[model samples]
Target: MSFGDLLHQAGGMGRFQFIHVTLLAVPILMMASHNLLQNFTAATPEHHCQIHDRDNDTRRLNVTEQPGPTTELLRAFLPLDATQRPANCLRFTAAQWRFLNPNATGANATRADVEPCLDGWSYDRSEFASTIITQWDLVCDFRRFQQMAQSIYMAGVLLGGVVFGGLSDKYGRRAPLIWSYMQMAVAGSCAAFSPNFISYCIFRFLTGMALSGIILNGVCLTVEWIPTNVRTIIGTMNGYCYSVGQLILVGVAYAIRDWRWLQLAVSLPFFIFFLYSWWFAESARWQILTGKPGDAVQELRRVARINGKKEEVDKLTLEMLKCTMQREMASVKSTYSVIDLVRTPTIRRITCCISLVWFSTSFSYYGLAMDLQNFGVNIYLIQVIFGAVDIPAKFISVLVMSYFGRRVTQAGSLILGGLAILANIFVPLELQTLRTSMAVLGKGCLSASFNCTFLYTGELYPTVISKVSDDEQKEKILLQTTDIEKTKPTG
Candidate 1:
């Protein structure tokens, strides 16, 4: 019998596989947290140019706290926009400040040319105490740095997918998987104490690198162990875990207003996961393919014991395993590379089509995710809703993909998502409620598209190139698209 056939006879889709897949889901949850952590950690709060109160009189009169004489004085001289809100990045000069008085009766204040903030920017600490924007002053002319920091992190993910993908294919899945978890833990922890933006980006990049391994290896490990028939269910369940984690992040960020503490909070979980990494089982099939029949047999026996099938597994001798490994190895070739994916006409067409789907899905999904506040609602509440909507969408995608097939579910959802995105363009800005609803609906459809695309891609690719070639290409496309989006001015 083939290894898969043997595995089916041993005990496919049993308690052993279920528990193993569940353990693997922890990293998936953390991946979601790590991926979207930037939305809060780099968020820019309401801010205004710091007025230099030389006399130290206005320092205590924060307008957000309470209005006072000092507050009125600063408001009179500070440049106001068309909406009458204080200009965040510009202020009146000291010479102009002297002529303006809060208590003067009918005194005409001469308009002065606005200058860039000299002292610093004052942040509204009501929602957040410190973010990358507040910590490094990535506001005003420096605002691009915040988005660049995010792109830098995504670049790390791109590179990680390339490097770790090869390493996992070369080495067994377990070692690379453990190494990625540790790297993420160490790098993410260090990121919390980053003294400057440069160091933070460096650590975040490393964390992103490690994240690719977790994703690539974790999914591979779970899928390899489980029966092929149940791969879709498991994959969808993983997506659900990711979306649930996104919802939980809303509370985590809301409670921990400081960016450093939030970073620390998110990173610390990886340490626990790293320690639990010891229990992770190596892929028996990988061992058999790599010429380690002895280890493969031992792992299979262990799995059988865990699933309470020792009686049937014991009847299978060492010779049976050796023969099965030889047959598997004889049929398998080690001469594959990413170039071969496009070497054939059929594969090239498949690659191009899937790549486009991945690019568009990622662009719309993440763009909508990051633009949650643009829905004209509370940012935190909107983010929570966005995440909440994804849970049902993920489960539904699995059902639809299973019943309606991959292409139909994938194409239909993508079309719906695109339409939902265009819906926002025509909605009147004054109708905030309607616009927000459209955005939420669009996010839900895009979430479904995201889930379906991944499932479809998995079903489309041959097992040999799934983690290596396809994942790398998809992540690179996502990073490239997101980087371009970040360069555009925020609406």
Candidate 2:
């Protein structure tokens, strides 16, 4: 019998399982928050060139409340777009500012020589008090650096996923998880105090590594403890925790207003996770598979005792676990590494298809998530709606996956998500509500696809290779998501 089957015989899907899933799920909220923290941390708020004469004066005015003299002067000093809004990148020289009249002809305005922002920039502080963009001046020429930071973080996640997935398979799930939690806590806390953008990127990368371990191993641990019948429910709930965190982030970002404090607020709480992780139970199956039947027996006994299954504990013993491991070992044809995922023809085909699915889901989901402010709506309200839609999306996804199975659910959700995104192309810019609605719908569909892709990919692998190879493939594909998202805004 499989380890999941054995777990089923030992009082699976009970109070012990509930507590396990919940504990694993709690950290997911933190992962969710950290994954999208860039949305606020690197947000590019309204900014403009700081005219030299009014360096201090400009800082005091709201973006909408442009000073009368400065506004009139800017008409001469700044080039206008077709909409008549001042161009963001170009400003006339100081001499041009002095020579201009309020009633200067359009021809005279055209004669002014323009230059890039030379006196630095001022930002609108009404919505955000400060962000990484303002903190390090990551606008204009430095804008691509922020996008690079996001990609760097995602690359870090891929690195951690490979390392920790192997560690979990070799050393067992629980210990590496504790280490990941600590890694995230320390690295994230340090990031809040980053003095420069490069240091901040390094810290964020480390945090991403920790986040990958938490997400991969957390899901693995929870899946091993539950029975097959409720795996869908528990997995769906795991995805919901991320949405819960996203919802919480909308509130937290609104309250914190500053990137450093916001980073601190999100990072410090992870120390609590590190402390709580001390109580986490190791995976009983990992114990048995690695030739530590004694530890496996003890873990099973603990589960049985907590679940009130005394008779089941009586039935479980060291010798039985050893024999079961022996049978499992004998049945395996050969040991395989992550390389085998593409080494064989059949495995290679499956890997490529599933990797594509994973790539698309992650690319669309995060790309939309990171650009939440670009939709031209009330950002806070849209964030709430985007997050709120996940609740029903999960519910509907569970229903569809349960009835129609993984393949249909994956294809259907992706198609629907594409349709929703395409529908937005026709939404007139004037209809902000319609555009926001379509974007939210697309996000919800992609969110559902994201959850289903994990479930489907997990189901595709053999139990022996499931923990290591499968997760690595998914992470490898997910790593490309940041690279893909890097190109999205330009398109």
Highest TM-score against the true fold, candidate: 1
The TM-scores of all predictions, comma-separated, are 0.88, 0.87
Candidate 1: list runs displaced more than 4 Å. Answer: 54-72, 95-110, 325-327, 464-491
Q: Per-residue alpha-carbon lDDT of model 2 for 1-491, expressed as tens digits?
A: 55655676678777788888887888888776788898888888877676555433443343225644355455545676566667676777743543346565666756777789888877877788999999988888888998998998898888887788788878878888899999999999999999998899999999988888887777768776777777767778877888898899889988999999999999988899889887778987667656677888888888988888888888788776656557554434445577756765666787898878878878887888888778876667777888899889988988999899988999999999989889988889899888878888888899888878877766665444332366455422212100011001100
Supply every candidate's count of residue pairs whose N, Cα or C atoms clash at under 3 angstroms: 0, 0
Give model 1's TM-score versus the native structure: 0.88
Candidate 1 per-residue lDDT over residues 1-491, each given as its tens digit: 56776677568888789889988897677776788898889888888887655434443345424433345555544676656566788877643444345553323333566678888887887778889899989999999998898889888988888888788768978898899889999999999999999999999999988898888888778877887677767777888888889877898999998999999898888888888888888988778767777787788888888888878678555688777556556535555677856865666887899888878888888888876655667878988888899988777777887799878888888888888889889888899888877777777888888787765666555544322366455411111110001001000
Worst 10 residues of 2 by lDDT: 482-491
Model 1: lDDT equals 0.75
Error of 2 at 347 (Å): 2.5
